[model samples]
Target: MKPFVKWAGGKTRLLKEIEQRLPADFDEWENVAYVGPFVGGGAVLCHMLEHHNNITRVIINDINDVLIEAYRFIQDDPGPIISGLKEMESIYNALSNEEQKQMYYTSRKTFNDMDGIDCQKIILFLFLNQTCFNGLYRENTKGEFNVPHGKYKNHRILNESNLWEIHDALQTVDILQGNFETVGRRLLREHVFFYLDPPYRPIVEKGNMFTMYDRTGFNDSHQERLKEMCDYIDRRGWHFMLSNSDSRSSDGQSYFDNLYNGYIINRIEVTRFINTYNATQRRPKEVLITNYQPPQQ
Candidate 1:
């Protein structure tokens, strides 16, 4: 089970590190409610659902409302999306590279204009992600989809079998849009295991890191607020393991180390696959913080 979209911070490469750090007795925990506060590409969510049968209930939340809606459309019915994507793929792949670039820009305008059928909006969302530069979902101050064309000669706009598989997997889960805090607040009484992959704090200078998932980018204050949420989860006796960028700030201060002072911080060397103009930043680092030590440890 793979993510339907290519997200910037998707955890596909770090899945091994995350799997190793899960609660030692996770398999034994029956009737578990699995919660993902920031389900970007849903790599971990799909992993949990495929490997663990103990998760009786599943809930995921994301700040991007349109992304959440696309998930919903997939969960409910993927026939329309599949058909639309097939047509788009046929048209795009037959075109020359120059024509494909022009088509990409036109689609971007239509997506940003946002005055089309609801179903078309979702279709364009997937189209842009598959063909956009580096699979980025960035927005301008006006909340526009502004990523440039990828100019690829070949495209995989439609993955029919994968879409059907994803649709089947999503049937058992509840998808939510809005703040991450709301997921725990409503399910406080349930025994939940949260795997958080919030927008990481930038490890490099401005205009380098891909932090703009939505119109309102996550800043330092938002990182502090997320730490408070993690504290709330810990206090409630809920299990959680979070992933974030591990690079230090300009002053050589460990920001996450200071924020999650009491938690167990595991620094893991990682190589990201996302396309970047600067090749030097390809091999970045990440940290995994868990409230309780994993059984493997």
Candidate 2:
């Protein structure tokens, strides 16, 4: 199953190593409840479903309402959504750059004014996501979508087949829109595994910062709150696995080391394509944290 959204902090690159780190008997454990407090791309969730059929129930939650609404739409009328997105993409391709900008801002304004999930709002969301720079779902202070138009003319706005596959995969899971802490409070204690991929702390002074979908950025306070929630889960005996930047630049301190001190942490070298212009900056290390100890070799 494909991810429901093109999230900024998705873990698509680290999926393989993360899978290998799991115990061989991980899937055989009965009554498994897979929980993702920050279900960005849903790549890990989809991987679990495809590989480990032992997951009895899955729960995913995100604070972004637009993302949640997209999932709901996928669950209901994926066909119409795909069709609408295709129409929008076609119209977008025919426009000049100035016209495209006009359409993007217009759709964003209409989306902000929309009260509910009417057809128009859904189309607007799809249109903006496809046209916006990097498929980013950014909003302004007043909660209006504000990302500018991207340069891509042949964007794959509607992936119908992938949407259908995701719809099928999500049929057995519960997807909700809420803060992670609120969802974590009601979780049961036994046979549960969590995968957390929060927005990574900035390596550079200004590059890695991301405005929240609703315009509220996840700052130091939010990170502290997440740490508190993770600690609570650790106390409850639930397994925890997390990934974050492993910056080794001279001027910066490692975020994972500073925040997750005294926890089981592993540093891995992962190559990521940092920019379309220069691929040299792509090779960077990332840190993975797990509550469970890996089996000895």
Candidate 3:
């Protein structure tokens, strides 16, 4: 099972490196407590649920309301979402080329204008994703979905098989919508592990112009706050693994290296599948900071 919803900073390509660096006992330990503070597309969560049989409890939280509820509805009920997508697909395909372009913008406006969360809003959310450029989800300062329509030969808006698989994978998962700081509030001390994939700290100064998973931007302060949490996690004797950009700040020094200097910070060459400028250009360095150093591979 894989994540159906594609979001920015997803770790689909780095899953292997991430798995190897995990605590050695992760796969064997039973009755474990797992927490995902910034579950974007749940790439790690999906891997753990399918591969790690010992996890007893899982708590997945994200500040994005639409993303969190999408998980909830997918796990609890996906029939309505799928049916709505089918209707949308039919309506979109029946239009002429020009009509389709108009329809795409119209749908985007309706998606942004939606009020009061319902299955329909969720449906539009998925629809916009399918038709949006590069499947990218971006929003403006007004908390509106503003990504332009994408031109694709053929798109699959509804994937019943994958949705069902994702639904099954999330049956025992606890989904929450809130800040990342509150994630570890009620979590137990021992036998708990946290995998944090927060918004990437921009490499270039003021380079985070379009990093809008949420309108509430994650800036340097949030990065510092996350560092403090890592310190706390170590002091509390809990295990944690974090992924962030390895871009050097304007000072020509690795910012993440300084932030996570005390911990086991390992830099790995990563491939970016979705390139901002060009998809073909995708070689970059990403830092994986862990509290515990697993056995060498």
Best by lDDT: 1
Model 2 regions more than 4 Å off: 96-98, 204-208, 247-253, 271-280, 295-297
Clashing pairs in 2: none
Residue ranges of candidate 1 with Cα displaced over 4 Å: 188-190, 204-208, 275-279
Clashing pairs in 1: none
Off by over 4 Å in 3: 94-96, 276-281
What TM-score quantifies how close candidate 1 is to the native fold? 0.95
> Candidate 1 residues 1-297, lDDT tens each?
799999988888888888888888888887899999899889998899899998989999898878999999999999999999999999999999989999999998988888644788999999999999888888877788888899787778889999899999999999998987778666745568989888887674343566678888787888888888889888889999998887466777777888899899998877777743233667667789999987654
Clashing pairs in 3: none
lDDT-wise, the better of 1 and 3 is: 1
| Two-way lDDT contest, 2 vs 3, winner | 3
Error of 3 at 45 (Å): 1.0
Candidate 1 or 2, higher TM-score?
A: 1
Tell me, by TM-score, which candidate is best. Answer: 1
Q: Give candidate 2's total backbone clashes.
A: 0
RMSD of 3: 2.0
Instruction: Tell me the deviation in Å of residue 8 in model 3.
Output: 1.3
Candidate with better TM-score, 1 vs 3: 1
Residues 1-297, candidate 2, lDDT per residue (tens digit)? Answer: 667566665667778888987755687788788888778768898888888888888888887777777877787768878878888888877888788788788887788888877666777887777677877777688777777777776566777788899888888888889878866567665778888877665555445555365666676677778888778878888888887766433457666677777777887766654331122456566678887786543
